[model samples]
Target: MTATTAAPAWRPAAPVPCAAPLPAVDRLRVAPRADGWTVTARVAVDPRDPNLAGHFPGQPIYPGVFVVETLCQAMAQAVPGTPRLRAVTSIRFLAALLGGDEMELTLDVDPAAPAAGAASPTEPGWTVRGTGRRHDGTVTAQLRAVFDAGAGA
Candidate 1:
């Protein structure tokens, strides 16, 4: 599909329907919403997970960056169109998420409103957020993001 022109505000990419179904390899469960996407996932720190080494030596906590990426994937699955993370404005690692923690990523896209710089309801621009809630019911981290422009951006 052709990419749409980006507006002054963050316009979400054209919404891509999530009818294709989730991939079996994905341990993440995606719940889509008009506002933003939510994801529940687990990390084993296996070699399969990207950038496992960057986490730490011996003690492997899931990388906070990965948490945001996972949330991005979840939001993409949920959001209609080509909503992509333009940038992570702010990310805070409030807690260390262990490999065993079942992470809950709740992204609040439209809620931030003016600050989020999201597009109008009628606009193609979409907002994205990242929240990491561990299986232990503790918050691991939170991410706020904005996206616009580019072919695969």
Candidate 2:
């Protein structure tokens, strides 16, 4: 079964963190990636993030779902779906994202994918692909996310 999360019309003070490591949540720092936004951002794994409880007690590694979610969060700004989550396709976690491990999120937005497609604009969906890498370039996770702003609508 697929789960859908809906938020009321009011915005909150602090941004809500992604609840589970995966399975969807409200996270991501920036809004969207600009045309030439080539900068890479660092994301830290938090043990206090509440996702650890059920993930595994003694070994609370960030689940593959959340690893996909992390990529989702990192690329959200570029998707035109502020405070919203679209969809993730071909999402997979190659390795485990562990708590306390500093994570580097790198996303390469397909230039072929537009800010506004022939179909939608404000909901400029993005054909986004992201990978979570450790300092050594070890790929922990790889994600293929297709985001449409209207997805929430």
In candidate 1, residue 54 scores what lDDT?
54
Off by over 4 Å in 2: 1-14, 17-39, 78-85, 111-124, 150-153
lDDT of 1 by residue, 43-93 (tens): 333433434455565566666667665655555654455466656777899
The sequence of per-residue lDDT tens digits that candidate 2 reaches over residues 1-153 is 111533223221234344533423232333223462331446566666677766778666766666555555554443443434455666666677777776666666643354534334344555666767766678877766665543345
Q: Tally clashing residue pairs in candidate 1.
A: 11
Quote the positional error of residue 38 for candidate 2 in Å. 4.1
> Residue 3 of model 2: what lDDT?
19
> What's the lDDT of the predicted structure labeled candidate 2?
0.53
**Per-prediction TM-score:** 0.58, 0.60
Task: State candidate 1's TM-score.
Answer: 0.58
